[model samples]
Target: MNWDDMRVFLATARAESLTAARGTLRLDPATIARRITRLEEAAGAALFLKSPQGYRLTEAGLRLLAHAEEAETALSRGIGALSGSAEQLGGTIRIGAPDGCATYLLPQVCARIAEAHPDLDLQILALPRIVNLSRREADLAITVSRPKTDRLHGERLSDYKLSLAASRAFLAAHGVPKSVSDLKDMRMIGYIPDMIFDAELDYLSALGVTRVPLASTSVSVQLQMARAGGGLAVVHDFALPTAPELTRVLPGDVALTRTFWLTTHAGPKDARLDRITGLLRDGIRDEIARLEAMPVARNP
Candidate 1:
C-alpha cells in the first residue's frame, strides 16, 4: 500500500470533502481522487460513499479510522525522531472541550502555544456534548469530570467558579430575586435537561430548576440567551468577563464550582505529546485564573 494514499485518506476523512482535503494536502483535485481510489482498492472495500454533498465514510472506513490514526501518529513520531526534534513539540494535536472552555479560554491559550511552536498545528473541537476520546475524536479532551473508564488517563487542571447571572435589563424588568427560592418564579435559562451530557453540567437541576423555558445545550448559546435578557443562567465565572452585558445574581447564595479535567488515551507515551500537554496545562490554568480574577458586575 502506498503510504501517501493513507495520508490522503486521513485528510479526506477529516474534512469529508475532496476540495477541502486538496487545500490541506496542497495537491490537485485529480491526484487526490486517484489516491482515494487506490486506497479503496487496496482496502478491498468502498471507503467513502460519494454524493453531491461530500464524502461520507462507509462502515469499513469507520472501522479503518482507528488504524489510520495510529499509523499517522507512528509516522509523525518516526519523522520527529529522524529529524532529531523528538523533544520539541511539533505535529497536530486536536483537543476536544465543552464550549464554555473552548469559547472563552482556548482561543488565547492555543494561540500562545501555536505562536511558541511555529511548526505545530492545533485544532479545537468545541462541542455541546462530551468528546469521545476512545474513538480518537480528539487527541486530548478537557472535560468537566475525569475519565470514568480506565482506557483513558486524566489530570485535574483546576477548579473554576460559576454563579447565576442575568442581563442588567433582565434584572430591571423582572426584579432581582433576594433568595435562591425566588429563582423558581422567574425566567430560567439553562441546558436542555435531556441533552445534559455530563453530571457536572446539570447545574440547574441541583439548584432545583426543573423547567427551563429558555434552554440550549451550548454554554455559549445559553450565555447569549441570558445576555439577551431571556433569563438567569449559571454562567461560568471565567466567562463573565467576555459577556459584560450580563451581571452576577446573588453571588453568595447561588454560587457553583466545577473542575476541569484533561484526559487522553491510556496507551503508548509520546514525548512530543507529553511536552505539548504540559504547555496546555499551564496555558489553561493561567487563563482560568486570569479570567476569573476579572471583576464581574452585580445588580444593585
Candidate 2:
C-alpha cells in the first residue's frame, strides 16, 4: 500500500533487471529486492518471477502495473504544474541513442540544453543495441528504425548520409580505389556481421561488400581502426568531420542514406520533454546541413 513501494515495483518491472532498476533508482540491489518482497507481502500475492535472465512480471504484477503507471502519470503532471516556472523546472532526462550519434552529436545537444536549463540533468546512454522505451530503459530514444508499438510515439528526426572513408595514411599505403570494383581488393573495416544491432547498419552490403576483413561491434572502434590505417570504413558524413585527416573513398560512386527516429513513451506530458525534443530536432538539422556541405575527396 506504500506509494514508495509501488514506485520501486514499477521501476523493477520496467527494467526487468535488478541492476538496471538500481541504476534508475540509485539504490542498492539488496534494497530493491527487499522493497519488491515487501510490496508482494502487502498485496498478498507474488509480483515477480526471478530468473537468470532477469525478473519477469507475474500475472499479479502485470495487473498492478497499469494502476501504478496511472498514479505515476498523475504525480508527474502535478509536479510539472507545481513547478511551472522555467527557473524551477528540474529533473533528469535519460536519452538512449546509437553510439555514433550519441558520441559525436549529443554532447553538443546536451550542452545547449544545459545552457538553457542549468538545473536539469541529461543522461545519455550511447548504447549499440536498441533501447526499450516500453520498459522505461530510457526516457527518450533515438533509433535507426521506428518502433511499431502503439505504446510509444516517434518521428523522423533527420536523414543523414553515409559514405566510404579511409585515413590519408591508409590510402597512401594501400592505393585509392578508383571504382567500386577496386574496393574488393582493399581491406574493409565494418561492423561484425552477427553483432550488428540494427539492420540499417549493415553498410558493407549496400556497397557491394559481402565480407569484412576487419570488423568490430563498436562504431567508435571501427572509426579508430580506419584512422589508424587499418582499412576503409563506411562512416557517417557528420561523424567524419571529427577526423579531418580521413578522406572519403569513392565519394561520388558510393553513397548510403539512413534516418534517425526519435521516440518516447506515451506518458504524462512534461514541458521539459518538449523543450529537449525541440533542441534535438534543431541540433540534428544543423549537423545534417554541415555534413551536406562537407567536401569529399575524389580518387585521382
Candidate 3:
C-alpha cells in the first residue's frame, strides 16, 4: 500500500539479494529486511521464498509484479514530466552492447553524455552474450542482430566494416596475406565456432576461413592476440585506432560488413530514452564516418 514499501519490494524482487538491494536502495541490510517484512505484513502474504540462490518470488509476489511495474513506470513518467527539460533528466540508463563496440566506441560517447548531463548514470554491459530487453536486462541494447519479437523496438544504428588484420611484428615474422587464397597459410584469430553468440559475429566464414588456430568469445581478446603477433584477426574497422601497431590485411579483398541495431522494449515514450538514443545514433554515425576515412595499407 505504501509507495516506499513497494519501491523496496520491487528493488529486492529484481535484485533477488539483500546485499544487492541494499546497494541499490542505499539502505542498510537490516532496514531492507525490515521493509520487506513490513511489505509482506501489509499485503498479508509471503512475497518471496528464500533459498541459497536468493529470493524467489511467491505466487502472490508474481501477481503483484505487473502492478508494481505499472506504478514504477507512472512514477518515472511523473518525475520526467516535472523535470521540465531533457537536460534536467537524470537516472541510470543501462546499455548492453557487443564487447568490441563497448571497448572501442562507447566510452567516448558515454563521456560526452556525462559531460552534458552530469546527473545521468550510464551503465554499459559489454558482454559477448545477447541482452534480453524483455526481461529488463538492459534499458537499451546495441546488438549485431535485430530481435524478431514484436515486444521490442529496433533501428539500424550503423553499418560498419571489418577486415583481416595483424600486427606489424606478426607480418614481419609470418608474412602478410596478399589475397583470399593466401589467408590459408596464415595463423588466423577469430571467435570460437561453438561460442559465437550472434550469427553476424561468425566473421571467419565470410573470409573463407573454416578454421582458426586462435579463437576467443571476446573480440577484445582476439584483438589482443592479434596485436601480440599471435595471428591475423578479422576485426572491426572502428577498433583499429586502439592498436596502431597493427595494419589491415587484404583490405579491399577481404571486407566484411555488419550493422549494429539499437533495440529497446516497446513501452511508453520517455524523453530521456529519446535523448540517449539520439546521442548514440549521432555518435555512431560520426564514428562510422571516421572509420570509413581511416587509411588501410595494402600488402606490397
Best by TM-score: 2
lDDT of 2 by residue, 33-120 (tens): 9999888999999999999899999999999998898787777667766554465447888999998888878888789778877888
Q: In model 2, which regions exceed 4 Å deviation? A: 17-20, 26-30, 51-53, 87-89
Give the per-residue lDDT of model 3 (tens digit) for 1-300: 888888888888888888877866899978998988888998999999987788879999999987887787777667666553655647888999989888888888888888888888999998879987654668889999888887688898999988788988889888877678877788999999998988888877877788899999999999999889998998888888777878888877888889999997667746677777888889878877787687766444
User: What do the candidate models score in CA lDDT, each in turn?
Assistant: 0.87, 0.84, 0.83
Expressed as tens digits, the lDDT of each residue in 1-79 for candidate 1 is: 7677887888888878899788768998789989889888888999999998999899999988778877876776666
- lDDT winner, 2 or 3: 2
**Cα lDDT for residue 34, candidate 3:** 90
Identify the superior model by lDDT, candidate 1 or candidate 3: 1
Number of backbone clashes in candidate 3: 0
Lowest summed lDDT over 10 consecutive residues: which window, candidate 2? 80-89
Query: Considering only N, C-alpha and C atoms within 3 Å, which residue pairs clash in candidate 3?
Result: none
